[model samples]
Target: MMSGPAQKYVYTKLDQIKEGTVVNLYGVVKFFKVPYRSKGTDYCSTVTIMDQSNAKLTCTFFSGNQDTLPKIYSIGDIVRFHRIKITQFNSEFLGISSNGFSALVFEGTAGAPALPRTSSKTYSFTEEDHKIVESLRIWQMGQQTFSNLRLKLSDIKPEQYFNLICHLVGKAVLDKACYLLKVWDGSKCALPAWKVCVEEEALEGDADFLSLHQHLTVDVLVYDNHVEAAKSLKVGSYIVIQNLHAKLHNTCNENQAENSYLEFHLHGGTLYGRGITILPENDIDVQELQKVLTTVNLNEEPICSEDLTSHNRLSQKSPPFNALERCQQLSVTVLPTRQEWLTTPLSTVVKMKPPQKYRVRVRLRIFQPQHLYQSVKLHCTKCSSLQAVPDEERLDNILQGNYTNCPDTDAQNAYWYQSVKWKRNQENRTVTIHFMKKHDMLQIPQESLIMVEGGTFKEFCKLSRKFNSIIPVTCNQANLELDLSAPFLVQGNIWHYGCRNCSSLKSIEALSSLTLEGSWNATEIAKALGIKPLTYVFVMNLTLEDETGSLNAYLWRRAAEQFFQISASEIFMVNNLQEQLNVIMTTLCPPGKSIGEYPWMDCCIKSYHSCDGREEQNLYEIFDTLIS
Candidate 1:
């Protein structure tokens, strides 16, 4: 980051940085923790940076005054750190402020101002340094969603962080270190948002408008160091709350968590870059947020929480502007309800804390299960699980191996199913064929479900040709049992598979409570019997790229079905449907061609922590999108 003699003096590249040496370096801000009052006297800020080499460095800067710290407003902003020591910490290299360390920041928008945002009026600025910043700005435009972190309230999810640009309508002092800031961003949160009551109250400009539209307002609890910042914010002024924590209220009673809901908590510390940063008049996002506010329905009737059912809470959200038109252009899937949030960058999408949704635009890079046939899988709804579609040949071997077990009972007289002896395969006891006689067809109806105790897979196939479905089972101590080795249910060449560790077997008697139709409803029957019916579903990892970045998302389950306009079952059962899927895939990412050949899709995507809370499990998921 310093101007120097051509070819004689070059600023240190982040990749070429050496430990123990102090050097001036420039990098694009990948992430930054806002300057917060550290445990010590200094204000500390943590920043992660990268260069064209793709080498990233995590650096910490400390200053007696917060203003002197690097002014990083966005993710892709350029920064020049002068005189920082490169040291190894916890086995990873880190940049720490050294003697005489000074920082300068620049806008990352290409062709924008190259002037540095700094406290110092006088600093080295030359043609070479200007070119370096320009080069970084140009490169960052293609990296990803590095422009902004602001999010609408409607898209919030629990246990995540986001930046909110909103009008401050009301404020109330809570406890000594906490303040409740009631604000709205025109949009309404899908999940129930909170409103806190305090002894004292204050109101102003936007309060009356927000009071009428109480449902749109969200209670933001600003705590500790952030309390001071929120106190000065005037009602009706546009403001941005940085690193706001959208979390479940921790005070809810464990046994009775009915009161537990999502609350915006601006926790005391600035460790993860928390706190309010800019005003409405200064930032660009607030300008658009202002436009959304004007669109709020002022004449709308206000309803209390008790009056509004959960389904009607967020009756509607930002209406998709030209969403139909955009979908028709190239999007494979579109949100059920048209959405207003425009397409976000993939890089920005990845940085988002989970449990929320966003609109994004991307082109298919590649799809997993390179052999498309392998993409079809059987998914269990009860306990989320995916397994390969059961192979008939393998299942045949399992049924033949277990046919010797005497699994039938004579007590079938009391139940809807009646037991009968098979003519062959009499290993020890007679093979009992428990026939569900409710079907109106012949004695052994094709629409019925048959449970057998002793029969080979071949014999079951012979019976299934006449009957539509058959389950091979055993009786143990008056209890019906199913070992997971073979298919739980077999219909011709089709086999239904379940989970390895999550499934527990229940008896056919479980279905006795439900009324039967002419044909068995497999999903309803599976639910009744505690047998997870496996439905063929598409589960494939896809690489979606845009000018900013690439995101790898799972085109899975209902999302996949909607995207293809063909159910996984239809694709699995019909050859033409499978061929149709191939044509769609080929269109999204054609064979042996440049990326420019791929089609673009305007989509809705969600990013979040995985169920198990594993960091690696955090991923981007394609949702509310369809391939047309």
Candidate 2:
């Protein structure tokens, strides 16, 4: 018979019971068998029971005084065992013998509370209970314990007994009979988290497997019967796992040298006594762990595989070479004439192999030459040391148009240059010309008759020839004649100046419609238009169409402000600016009109020579007062 207090029978939950501990627990009998002789030595009987926590425990009793326990405890009867020896068999269970001082009492009388038998009862905890659970000391990675210890992914060592917490960032990849979960936690190394390989049976029978599939809140992929308690969990649910075996896996790549990471398994070893326990998210330990995780900066963590590979590549030693030598090794092609190269579209330039050179006649028309040049210190590429160059002397030479006297030595190299942006082919183009041994600056005012040789490297196009590579060549602007007698009507979608050639005209009056392409943020719009910082500008692309042809026009801030009757700053403040711009475009260019008919508006056509020295034209329609 039970005495002392009724609560004394509430020992630790079956999952929390440690081996060698004398426990007094109350559990409802799930299964029971009459006493029978094992090897004809002593009578034995087996019974499985479950507590309010839903933890199952199997009780084995041997003959003597305890022989009547199996007969007294029937299925669905709540029984109390006092001082039973808690041991681990397939999992944690209890062992009792008639000779032992253990006692059993039935708690199914009218005085006891009626417990549910059809389903597992969830054990509720009070604040005091939560405090007690939190205060319990659990084994950590570096500790030696009777049971396996919990470890962080970084602390896991090869052939060690450990478990960890990780977020499942990828789908499980099945390899043969095991499912591998890719996990990661914000740690030092960029290596993938310990690979958690779960057996097929463990995954299929897990009740939480269905919940995990339905609501992917929990990042950990659990594989054991313990997951039955986590069926209510969802993705992002913080959990603590215990008792897993860790083994180191090598990539077997010679280049990867000694690189290795850990892999965790749930089965195959007695060291992991109870297989694995996936704690509920609300568990006190898991809540504490969640607090620790909140401080980790997962965004900056190096979890990208590509970044890891790149880091490995950079760690290796490499050689250095001169810029000219590097250029010589690339695939360089020199076209015969500028006309052929000019016909090559910008898209083609983007796809072509780098270090390509072209010989073309380019007119030099600097937009703001004063802002183009700046004094900058040069450095020796090999030693990474600054090279000494008198800035005043260099400026004097640049002004005098005698830029060829700069000295160049093995130890020191002087590279004084200016970046000039200018209008070419009615499009903006920029080039940086080094004033090394070239007097090219003198031709700036002359609309240079000299041949221009340049190269394209990476994203930079039309890189001017360095001082040492500049050569004098006799070339003239190709004579281009236009046939404008018969009016040249419409062609396929708006003709790109670089793609199609049109007859040069001073002005044209056309009935047209305008359609807004789109609007972008001020900063992004500025970047796309190559507008300098601090320059107040709002820009958008508009498609102007007529029965004859169409053109994609650039509407700068000044022109857009006049046409829209609002300041650029005010236009940016409109919440639905795109829709507003479309409305304006529709008013200017009414849709569904006859192919070539609309209210006639006079448009001034401007022409400029392209890189090939052939004229390209653009149309500008400004609302200016008509001169009487």
Candidate 3:
């Protein structure tokens, strides 16, 4: 001890200590390792100390008269060092030569009796010390200089020494004498360390430490001093790692290479020049990095199983509103009338004045009933293609809890079907509708008046289901009555026919109306109709007449069935033609009903001029009908 009263020792903080500078330091013993043989006969031991400023210095004690230094000093014991030589290795500033001439004095222990102490230093922690630790600023990865590279998992390279900050996901897995820690920073990785023996018994006994279940990717591997520091931490704790070794394993197989990931291992041996360092989650840099990580993860789409499970659990806790509630909440606003909607081009609707709501009413001709009625289909959960149910019935069953115990299948597999419908005169314009719910599906019917309540024009153009509602309206309330005297109505005798193509007939600028003067024969009407695609039902062609002239019109599957009071298949399958005709005549023009009293059939005339070499008269065809 070179400490006489005249030549007193000069004390210095670890940060200010310089190589070869002999100084005295007073601090708590942070950690210490048992003395071990170095080369031959020479024994060495290491101890770390942190001053009031939180600056750390590791001291290595070599063979000396005070060979029991490690056994005499304990963690958290306030101690004073005399004439310690400071040194630097691998850019790490530390103190060395805590042997010969350097004296260690344990403070407040000269006359005190021994007392019971916890096996782990964590139990000796005070709230004040915890607050101080939390307030300390952590060194950021970016702040690391060229000699000490700090890197993210994605930027890690093979055979490099780097520092990283990450979350401890699970308990460290013990492999032989080494510990494997699973860590993640959004990106996952593993960290392995050897020769770490701090708090081993306590860590092994902790239930949480033993049952760590989260699998994290290794971002960096820390060993020696750093691993010792980490072993005291619990799962889900954030930590700062220093001097980690990144190692890559070579594989010859391409598949193995594709499946391979980076592994971090802490170098315990002195070959790497120095060991690692660790900072607790309270470090300022760690907290700042954690904030940044939280912001980034908030923006990223969660693709992890944990995220999915959380989302599913949240959704299960709060189910969506039922169909009745949705319908009751819908509100209506003033919209374009039926005639204006029909005449105004879709382009005009798109270019309407600002602040204009996107809802309209129009009379649409129903050419195919299957387009609207059969659009929605329910798929089975077990085998989507094996079974299907209609939208209406499926929704009813769902509401009635009939599907509560669905076997080996997910009930969410049932979904509404989607299809498109074309306007009567404007065949080029189409509207797509999805039967997402029973209310939406039931609200729309073939050839019915509808009031689109609310939506944006862009959404309307896309026919998004986000719209408020598309409710069926009565023809009288919609003011959709047709003017029979309009000259645009196609006029001709029932028997007379032209050879015009159906395409040309669709070009006529008119709203054609037809009145059934008398009962029609079912067999005759069925024979004149055409079969709709996908459905085997027959459509009916009827010559609707008024005093001026008779016009050709066709009834689609649903309308034809309604007019004939029976399904098309039933009418076609009848063995007696007279009986089928009788059924159709009574239904088409019921007893005691005049031509004017019967429902008026509104239609659009579609025709094509003959293009064949032979001269031919233009034929007019009514492709679709709207019954009012």
Candidate 4:
């Protein structure tokens, strides 16, 4: 340690930064812009750094070459710079990289390897630098600044260029100039995301999976240079889309302008370091994303377990929402945000413009779907359709079809299925079984789904036990027509239905040429049958009141589940869970007490445009809050 005027310490901390002086500093990057091509034929990067003091310093660096600009991997990385000139700008100190500047970056996770992710090979890293980095990492681990840097899909607004950490679910080539990468972060966007139209065959991922996640998926159009890189990304790859431009979609292609709906684009060029970086499977960020995906089952088929054991296990693996503690609270405090100035009063939020996020402290006045069971509804992400769960009597009626008589047995695919004849009302009807090639005399329900044609409701109950799934179909002219009244497929004694408005039923012959990419995949089966499966979600409205005002906002999507700390689909399977929910609700809004006596919560509410044609209205939604 070189102290006592022999160069006392090697690096300057953020608090020691002064104006009109050239100094070397080591700090944690709170925020940064990907290196972008500037007007002067140089690449520039804007960054905000802080030390243990939490004093932020704004820095700008320009380089004739893109490689010289800081290659900041993320928002929380530690950076060391040599020879930066600091000057006062607009009553604040600004640092600009002067001549003979050198930079090195390191991961900000404490106890991790002290490795530099820099473009320069000749930069020096002494024992002192290592000590500073490890210390900074330890400091950063305790700060909420890292989480603040991550913007959720629910929080994104139009015309903002931001970085997104998400997983790819689907991809398609729009043309030679453009490619589409459909991704999600397990949160629903505020507005309806723009959908790109193309032949389903052109898609590189499961069509059913894409349709199932339409509510969560955002289509990012990669253009020019970025399209090639996007094409190489496989479905399910975890990636960081740096400097992703979010704008409204319109025929005029006006950049940074609002339109009817929003879309994301990676515009052509290396500007803004606008490219995708694939993260390893074992990456911490990827693991976080996977946890969200697993809980929601958006990437795969929903479990049909009879008990809540699976969902209970899921909760144990995740960060507990502490719903029990929250329900008992008499008062709730609003969580602090990095940009505290953005917090708006409820009275002001209603009058504000669309496409903005606000934080507010408010109390729960009341909530509805007063009949909690009614809140459990099936939603189609693909078509934005919401419907009630079909009753057993109604579903059974739909499954029972008119008796048909056909004498001919279509033994078309003897290689895959066996043809059976059923005598209905004294007439012989041909029932073609599409997946019983050479199994048991009576195939068990553990096998892949069996497609049956000209089958009835009574037939389903008998055959349901024979196979894992059963899809009843009818031949119309030359095309296969599935009865839209019933489920497109059924599995594990759980009835799953398709969205009537979204599904475009395909021919049974389509599966003749089908090749299974993986195991007995449910998503692929839905795609083969042109079925868009429905997702079960909880939806409710909460009337929140602050000192200023009260407004009606919905507790919807994943947030509702997060708030309850329970799965919507599994809530019904477990009797005690419903009692728990009732207890939580009653705690928030007591029956005997007046509205004034109700408890309060400091919530982060989002303001967005209503999709339903209340054109003059701006909608408010409660997001990211769990009671306990």
> Predictions ranked by lDDT, top down?
1, 4, 3, 2
lDDT of 1 by residue, 449-486 (tens): 77777566567667767876777776666655676766
List residue ranges in candidate 2 displaced over 4 A.
1-148, 167-176, 185-234, 237-243, 253-259, 267-271, 302-306, 310-628
Q: What tens digits encode model 3's per-residue C-alpha lDDT throughout 1-628?
A: 1222344345677667766477877655555553444534566667777765657888887774323443322234444565677755435666765444343333222223222121222222233323332322122112222123446765665555656767665445343324556565654333221111224453333445323322324423334334554466677676545446554432224555333334466544332223323334544445666785566542244346754453344334323423222112211111112212232332443344432322222222222323223321222222322111223344233222321222222112112223233332443332222232332233334212122211123322233233322221111221222111111111110111111111122211111110111111222111222101122233444454533344334444454443333433323223343265453344334457555444333333333445468785443333322221
Off by over 4 Å in 1: 1-10, 98-100, 110-115, 124-130, 144-149, 200-206, 232-238, 248-261, 294-628
How far residue 540's Cα lies from its native spot in candidate 1, in Å, is 42
The Cα local distance difference test for each model comes to 0.69, 0.34, 0.37, 0.69
Worst 10 residues of 1 by lDDT: 317-326
Native-to-model Cα distance after best TM-score fit, residue 223 in candidate 4, in Å: 50
Model 2 C-alpha lDDT per residue in residues 481-541, reported as the tens digit of each score: 1112110110111100110122223211110000012111222222332322231233444
What TM-score would every model get versus the actual structure?
0.43, 0.26, 0.27, 0.41
Q: Model 1: how far is 185 from its true place, Å? A: 2.3
Pick by TM-score: 1 or 4, better one: 1
Best by TM-score: 1
User: Model 4: what TM-score?
Assistant: 0.41
